[model samples]
Target: MVAIIKTGHSIRAMLNYNENKIKQGKAECIGQGNFPVDADRLTYIMKLNRLEKQCKLNENVKRNTVHISLNFDPSEASLPKEKLLEIAGSYMEKIGFGDQPYLIYKHNDAGHPHIHITTINVQENGKRIVMHNIGKDKSEPARKEIEQAFNLVKAEHQKKKEFKPEPVSVRVQYGKTETKNAIENGLNFVVNNYKFTSLPELNAVLKLYNIEADKGNENSRVAKHSGLLYHALNGKGTRVGVPIKASRFHDKPTLKKLEKKFVANEIKRQTDKSRIKNAIDNVLLRNNIIILPQLVKQLKKEGIDTVLRQNAKGLVYGATFVDHKTKSVFNGSGIGKEYSAKELRDKCGANLEKLKGEFQKAYSRDDLLNMIKEDRGLLSIDDITKIVDLLSKTESTFDYLNKDFLKQRRRKRHRRGN
Candidate 1:
């Protein structure tokens, strides 16, 4: 069972969308409880007719729509419509949907049961209301409540639970030496072979009679049959994990479990990235490399410009450069093959050169050079070699082999061996 609240769309648009879902008939309507007894049902009937007068009756109440859907394997015993309506009413009362105008219409046109609901966001007096947040709030609790009320064991425990229907065991008799009377009894034995929890178990039973079980197709109706999922448990037993197509399975717990797994993995990924960032920051600080503030100041001093913009890659730091000859808006990257701040500034000619000179005069070159040297010295000869090799490969130039590097490697190797 899942409850979804959607806002920011007109009532008519919402009605049409729900009407399409209802026409599929995958789920049954459970009736509304918020308004006068027949008022809720009246809206559902009226919405189906697309009657303008029916919708206008409650238009001034500032409506917001909520749809509640329940999905179960259809092969199992279905809850009676009267019982389903009772369940819906109890659920609404428990969740506090308020005694306002709301309708519950079951949709069975699809592959499963999804209930559509329309309600006023405010009470008859027109005060704003807070609704379910779905993943962030409601689904998990609702699932637990339903499982308890229905006396169905959690899906994980399906293997240990008994079947809901009477126990059926099967026995196989090989060879036909037994009389025709024995053959009828053997057939009875095979039909009672419904206890198995998995498809393989069910297949084993079918093999005895020389009748091969039809393996359902990818998109075929038989393939998506809900009964296969519920087959794990017979008499309201635990539900073994069964593959259900998106169209058939909509249990709240299943949805929450999926969301929980997704959120947990995402959180771990974000934490790992944070740790990586922290490690990089520590290395940069220890090596005295130019920090972000220093890099920004350097660009500003060099007369490099920047702007904020949104692109296909999302919100990003961007910049523009006017072509010197055409004076047209040219992106910073187009000013040169590489769009580094220094390269962009260089394209502005003498004024940029003068600015660079002024910037250089304002900072101590000795200090910046010392920082770079310190950072370089902090790395081992092997690390430095790897870095140089990477840069050489990228540039297609072996100019990275300076005399200082050869001396360091030779001295380091000698020191290691000694």
Candidate 2:
């Protein structure tokens, strides 16, 4: 089972979306709670709205509406309706919203059966349930428990079979083309699925599908002025068309929205630190692994993005891994000394400079042999001498590349010549 949560300002919009599905004969009301009157669509929305107005909360509390969906694997089709409801209720209880008034709608509009949940996040006392790291901190653990108790397929296993959003399909916004719809869906997918620490790390996953949440420059008028601009990006990081204000996006993935996510993701990803360490171990265990880019490309398939932190002189000083699956950021040192940025060159048996650009990662012995076919064949005695020179320079990669020292030397040489 997989759970996705969204908090918004309006309960009416969510109630209507599910109610409209019922009107279309595509969905049916399964269960509801905390309504003053009968739990029909009308009373449901009225009671929730009355409660929100009664609380008299300010607009700053953006999570007044809680919209979530629980998706089940197609293989679990034979599960009884009673167990499904139990699971839903159990999940809600574990996620810290069980006591709150909520409505459940099971939709058969798609090939597989799934359910939508709607509830106001504000309590009777007018306090909002904390939304920070709700997904990783709460949902993931609850999901594992539910999956075990219900005997369902694991989500991690399902992820391998799922198709991620494509770049071109997600970026185009012509003539009410699914651009708007796609962005909303894609944002939900990325937020719920990938564990990202910071905005740029999150954007790396978002931009893959041509979507970006640009906060503008720190000194720029947009940042000084305050607000977020979400725009479509091309295959390049450039904007494809007009940008949408953060407020304009339905889910409102504003800086505040994402900051909450980042903090949550940081905590959530820690539980899966071992998973990342295992991935690094798997790649390094390969006998022919020879470059950083090759390892980086392979790690992407595992839903891990490797960021090589470099200085102004183009020397790598650190490495951070954005584990999208876990939604965590880890420094190379944080994981282990062996996996640190400085350790990678020695670990891969490649000089730092030679590892730049692109390199082919070898998966098999034959593949490894084929990769070096373009190389100058096997190394002779002369090649050995050159290899030693590279290794000596590789140990102190910053040599002759320090900008300050290089500038001083140039000035000194000019004065002496004059």
Candidate 3:
């Protein structure tokens, strides 16, 4: 089992997120304890309120909410609720939250069977449970003990570590089955198939499929650094390893060669828009697909990758479709305003009402646990336990999972979105 804990300020938002999913019938309120009404929303709110009310005695505790998810392997599916609760209780006791009131919510919306716990950090005595070094000092030890006691699959044994992009695996199966040949396959398919007026715009399409085109920084010391290269990317789109120079590819897709294609593609894509639009229309016409992930899967069958750009809050406001087979890039609005994020989301919302339970299978626990086995470089408990000393001082709630990645980018003079 893997545990991720976060400290936040709102009880309502966290509870509402899970409750909304439950109301949608995507999840269920499987079990609850230590509250007046165990099955209703009040069970969660009243307990959390009690914590906050007590914390008022302390006066300085601004952050009161604690959210944690316990994810188990697929093999552990059908794990009884009684056992799950026992594990949760043991975990709380080990982590110093045994006496604090909390609610456990089982979330099935993802590809794994997991439970969420929401509680406050403050005790009724108006004392704050020091969260310092909890992840390493307390939670880590508790997780291993729980796993051994339950005989659950250890994290290290989960899956291979390859970065397989979810909902878009169809692209690789169709062409470029080999990792080394992806450049030739993606470019041969894209260059002859799609249209783009610039390299950066083309890369937006390339980034979706893990084939990146690059020219070394202006002052790199390596000889022949001026040449363009192609690289593979991890799940996060960060480049990995040595790159294959543009000259090595059969088509010699160098910067100069691609610039020439850019002008021609502009004219070519103009004629191809109607054909491409029809393809997208055909998919949306189907009743089986809806929501973002399902829509991405259906489109991938035809070699299209739908990349949505969202703000920090996870609301997708813009989208891009990189057509690998035809090598075409179209903004949702560019394809047709009907394909824009707003329109698609609206359409998806309607279709979701009609989609059955099967469409959600892609997120099944088996599918999620399968990735862990494929997740190479996954750290084992033995490996983790070896690092006893710290490179920094005591790790607090902030060290638990507080990270802010700056998504910096230079504004493009040419608009990629319509």
**Index of the highest-TM-score prediction:** 2
Q: List per-prediction Cα lDDT, in the order shown.
A: 0.39, 0.68, 0.63
Residue 360 error for model 2, in Å? 16
- Cα lDDT of model 3 by residue, 153-232, tens digit: 87667641111222222233322324545555455445544587766667777776677777776665322444577777
lDDT (Cα, tens digit) per residue for candidate 2, span 300-379:
88988876655544456667787766666677777889888878745554532343222222233343334344222222
lDDT of 3 at 367: 36
Q: What local lDDT does model 1 show for residue 279?
A: 31
Best prediction by lDDT: 2
Residue 205 displacement in candidate 2 (angstroms): 2.3
Using all chains and alpha carbons, the TM-scores for the candidates as numbered come to 0.33, 0.57, 0.41
Candidate 2 clashes between residue pairs 3 or more apart in a chain or in different chains: 195-324, 195-327
